[model samples]
Target: MDTRELEGFLAQHAPFDSLDAKMLRSVATAATVITFPRGEQILDAFTDPTNAVFIILSGRVDIWNDADRLREAADESLSAGELFGFSAMLTERSVGPRAVAATPVTIARVPAAAVAPVFASRPGARFLAETLLSTRHQALAAPAYSSVEELITTAPLTVEPTTPVSEVARLMTERDSRYAVVPGPDHTFGMVTDSILRRRVLVEGLPPATPAREIMQPATATAVVGESAQEAQITLLDHGSDFLVVTDRAGELRGVVAPRDFAVSPSTAGVALNEQLRRAGTAEELDTLARQAPKMLADVLGRGLPSGRVIAVYSSIVDTIVRRAIQLTFQRHPDLSTEAFTWLALGSNGRREAVLSSDVDSAVAFVDGTPPDEITRYRAVFAEVDEMLVGAGLMSDDHGASARRTLFARTNADWRAQATRWLAAPTDGNGAMMTSLLVDGRPVHGDTGLPEVARVFSDLRRHPGTMRLLLQESLSSRARLHSMRQVLSRRNDTFDVKTYALVPVVNIGRWAALSVGSAALPTTERLRVAAGSAMLPRSQASTLIEVFETLQRLRLRYQLLQIREGIRPSDVLVLDRLSAIDRTVIAQAVREVSSIQRRMANVSNYVPTADWSSTDGL
Candidate 1:
């Protein structure tokens, strides 16, 4: 093989593609070409152990089920531009699927040592880590269940929206399934669960012949194939749903997983902890359950879960505790329930990214037409609710963002009016900060249908003034560094990770998401959607997402360590204390943020139009 041609081929594949010219040449020089005839096995579990990475250059390769060549695992085909044998070579283990050439195949065999330079590069290392370690990447030790794919026990029972309720129920019964997916024409879907049947049909005296669409409930929670099981568990815990409708990468129906699946695996104690939170009868009991969360966080982190997933698991459990506290409050004063309201988790909690030391940022959105007296009573109830949460170890927002503050709690109509005022007058100082926080608000409890404020923010995509304000805010928070190169600690060798690193990415992601009219709440999802819509370059978005994860993991690990040492957990980390590798990682992540901010400065001038057609010149 021509060395230059091999270099070109290697330059097109990821991890390898990120290699510099000199590194690429060295890798190309070290690579050797090997050919296999059709029906020949390349690597087998117990024979022909893989010693190098194999990139298919031509023709096809088939990877069979682990330890056996009897059948192929679902969708396990490798064509040109795909690679295999890397996992075996990286882990230095002769274990994995038997790879067989489906046709006359030419492969570029690159020894693991040849690609060591690629592994040292940021993008290359990230790709390797994600591909090899998976998302359970060593922030945690070993989770009981890693991905949602692990919990899938059966294929989804899909039905047309117009299918008769009786027929749907019969199909579910025949399959012994608890839910049936109702796919819509617009690539959306809903579910008709057994619980829906019992409550909406039987109890409501609806006819069995009613169209499934009439009784189908909107998807309460969903997960994509390959999503972490801990993430799926969080969805279940927060939504109080029986099952999560699983979808493939293309948003096609895949399968469903339930809480019962977690019950069986019992790897982490999250599900059990949530159950205790749910069953707690008093504030004291709830506080006790809440105190156990740190240990659970440590266990999750020990199991190799990433920081984002770890925070999500902890935050979801906290959501349950908050809801239970509200329930306990309601039990004491049932009259407060007479006024319909939605409890909104704002800021970090709303984004499901809170840490052990994070403050409670909350608000209350009452339904229109509630009496003035009842509104006052609702405020008092939330005050007690705040006290309970504080007793449970969460700190109240020192800025008075909690629902207990009258300024933060308002009727749906009032909230909408405030949002309009904020958007129209983007220069208002208080409104600008509030708008930033309010965009992250999500319903964690109560009616869960506060649409007024959402409607106001929905127009933000076309609101240039507000979009500029948000964009400016996103760029304002800079990573603490000396001359924009060396990471700098501010006080006593300590740096506020949340303030300097995490919050800037969060702000940038939120702005990017809103600019693209994306409704995604999580920062990662926001970055992803923004990239998909061309609002930001895909590679840049991926970099920011990686940086966010890196900093988040650092903060969570430091706080957990503090708690273990009997010190109060805080976002401020002592830079002098981090390991050499960790300190270097922080410096690299900080530089990445600096680079993104510089790039985003150009985007401040571009604006979305009424139709949301522009990509903000990103």
Candidate 2:
């Protein structure tokens, strides 16, 4: 490849985005361009990996493992700006061993060595590396967060502009609504609210037969169907309306955006965080906003979200809030670039299922460069903000997210090396440690490009022995599915309930997903996403998730009972307070545990050797 081509290619990756003219020229002056053809492997597991990560100049790369060629174990293709060998680079112990190639054209390899030193001196380099190290299969331009379709309150009240006022009131009452839409023949809408009923018809001395449009508010607030709920919030706030009519791209009315509905909706916390980020000027302000997250979920639950989905939604919001807070921290400290760094959220926070009183697990990710001096300064800033977040009500993780836990964060190269060692030779004792965090981790915040880090983590989990170990360790802790007699009635006397029962299912689903590289944020989600080729089918997976949810809700309800009674509750429970139906559900959940345990026993050869390698753990 020529100089012009090399510069163009490197320009497309991160770090280059924020590089000043002088730095850009410096990068251009010291880049090497390599070429590959279709089907040629650019890298593999056996290469003597270096600290430098690879950036695809162009074309597609297939990630396959001949050791286990099953569709369950391999990804068919990766495209432009997607990175490979990043895990190899990040892991200080063992380099990542994934292949790359040309779809039909040439590709380029930019050594982290050349720009790495310069990058280390620059905050942008740390940001770039952090982005890559986030999950080990880290990429160059991964999506910022897991994006999902927006849900809206689509079924709304409707009426014609010519409707009578008294009839409008009847329509509202019949539909159990306080507002209704009155659309003109041309499709323009006006709103008829409960307030209008009293003022326009009753107080104004207008006849009950007056046309609806006459009594309705003429100034209508509207939002497009795809517009974010935050936009809807602002529209309502700006127009002094309780709801905004949501229209489609073609301008047809799609639905109504109610303030209550938008505020209480699940998973759209990103919309709110995005808005907050746009207006944030300081990290302290962002920290203040994060404290409001739990209450928001508590309110959503009050609005009728099921206990399980409520936890998922609630945790999702908190993750987004904390993520934005970190982003704001980076913005405030321009000396610390997010581009070279990957931020890891740990423990309950990592899982996206935090309760109102939960702790945070987090670390800073950087790239391994020629000089150790490269990331030291950014590390100082990372230390400062890490402590700041703790003081802000996110308790420190019990598992020690503190730096005392041996530089728990590393560059893409360092992390990949460690993940490789844990995967290839994971001891029975600590096998669950690194991979546990990986399963709950969603890039709730920070560089999405680091999915490669996760890939590496998951790939290592494919080790059959680790599966056997996890299966054994987890099932040993399972509560009896059903006692010969009553179960929870004898809780502390029977099972600890919280750690012994729930954690097994949690860890089981987590290990299963890690073994297959499922990119799901929660254990329930992991089970669903991994059902395709897992030993369990979709129905079994659903049942497991259902059981897990039942257990969690039971725990939550017990807590609520304690709070209500001023009992100063613990997770231990009494089955007596539960409805007959709930008791039956718990019994069924216990039965599911039994089934999982039996299956685990078979997989583990519980009778003897307990061989965990079923098709190389795929």
lDDT of 2 by residue, 451-492 (tens): 445767656444666566655655666656444444546433
* True lDDT of residue 94, candidate 1: 46
The per-model lDDT (C-alpha) reads: 0.75, 0.58
Q: How accurate is candidate 1 locally (lDDT)?
A: 0.75
Off by over 4 Å in 1: 1-142, 152-219, 247-255, 266-269, 447-451, 482-492, 532-539, 598-618
List runs of model 2 lying over 4 Å from the truth.
1-288, 327-334, 370-380, 402-405, 460-462, 474-476, 480-497, 532-534, 537-539, 557-584, 606-618
